[model samples]
Target: MFKLRGRLEKHGEIFEIGQSVKSPILAVLPSLATKFYSNVPTPYEIVDAQEDRKTYQGTIDNVNRQVSEGKQGRIFAVVHVAGKQFKITEGDVFVIEGYWPPDAGDRISLDKVLLVGASDFTLIGRPLVQKGLVRVEATVIEKTLSHTKTHFRKKRRKQYMRINFYRIPQTMLRVNRIEIVGEVNHPPDVTGLETRIF
Candidate 1:
């Protein structure tokens, strides 16, 4: 019907009225539904998931390749996790605020690498580096609540007072390692630059 056509157009879709396809409302609706989904935009979760899927079968494979070539050592990277950015190194233990889903003892890989580095080189991601290029592994060590904070308010001579306390859930993570599976630029060789001795 004409009403259906207008609604589809509002959603930025267009349809042509076929001359020979004389079908009832029931049969045409199914086909229209299919077309609607195809034209509509997908949720960001689906989009990021499809793009972030790791293609590398094994991080060890790339590590072996790096070892064979003797390219670099002591890799570090900035990764995004739990709605926050963290600069992490191997064997680092850090706490992330808020409740995270993964249970303790669960190992997880974070691929939202903003930048990866080594003693010799750096690879900067436009927003996020390509999937399977840099892998950051971590283990959920503990999940616990933070120390309760007290909020107290009082007005002199008014006899008004209020008090509240709260503890935020937090997750503890240990950075297992960061592996670079692709080529990167080497950092400048300035031993004095590290300590600002210039």
Candidate 2:
């Protein structure tokens, strides 16, 4: 059996794009950035990485840190969506409102992964996704909820009140390794898709 991309719901439904969607679908939300840069530096390398294991580990750690700083993430972010603060889990989809900063706006892809354990092997982004991989796409389902109220007061007369509400909805995405391209800079083409990730 295939493992779930994120979390499963009590009565949720899974819809895979190709073949048949056998997995469950939940609300999909993008991650937020803790900090940002006006110009995110391109992927780079650290010198003398293989001089020592400790040094190599340190270099890896530093690279990961840089990636985190450049990309948007849920870590250390105090999101106040819809007048409420919430921490997003790995599989959660949060609909954030308000003006998205230009640098922070747009589809910010995340590769600073915490942990990715597939059923077969636990490979890092060295070999991103395998060929014939599954592609997942989710739409903004809705916005978070908000409340509105009206009240009337009068001397000796009874008071009247009314209220309205709204909530943010979201679509969930669960994509698999449709095609493992073996490199991040060069993603392979997914079958049926017009273009591949560049």
Candidate 3:
């Protein structure tokens, strides 16, 4: 007699009495085997710390050389603007929804950079990149209202109906340029309001 176990109890298997054999259920369902016997460690090769550091330093030096030579090529950046994040490149035009303070023709620098990329490499920031490292300049080209939207409500039996129309303000921005202004991994000094007196 063969005693089925767990979920396989419904799907019975035939075997000779007192015969010892591996579970056919595990053989049929490899995934279940992994769930039940998942303690096996995956194999990975280890590298020397000095060698790894040398490789990392070489990559940084290559990026720095490219930046210094002005050959990093067309750059792109993910910048935070008006509580929204936009992936922008030079000469790109994008819209910002809702009220913004910058007037048309006003030039501004987007400081909260989440990432910067070029043809060769990419730099990802933890919330934000180092200050003055990547500069993203843009111009407010126009400000206008979005298309009108209608909101309607109705109630059956009571015979109540309401209608409303609205439009949201939008700001248009044109990215002027994106460049690496400071060395990689180097941050500028933070001087907090030294010229102001309380």
lDDT of each: 0.72, 0.35, 0.85
Number of backbone clashes in candidate 2: 31
Candidate number with the higher lDDT (1 or 2): 1
Sorted by TM-score (best first), the order is 3, 1, 2
> For each candidate, what TM-score against the reference?
0.56, 0.21, 0.81
Candidates 2 and 3 compared by lDDT, better number: 3
How many residue pairs clash in model 3? Answer: 0
The predicted structure with the larger TM-score, 1 or 3, is: 3
- Tens digits of per-residue lDDT, candidate 1, 84-192, equal 9999999998898987889999999887899887775566788976556677999999999999989999999999999999999989999998876544322244433
Tens-digit lDDT track of model 2 for 78-197? 222334444333445655454333232233333333223223223243333333221222234343333443454445545655444544333222221121213322345545464557
- After superposition, candidate 1 runs with Cα above 4 Å error: 1-68, 155-157, 183-198
Report RMSD for candidate 1: 16.3
| Candidate 3 global CA lDDT score | 0.85
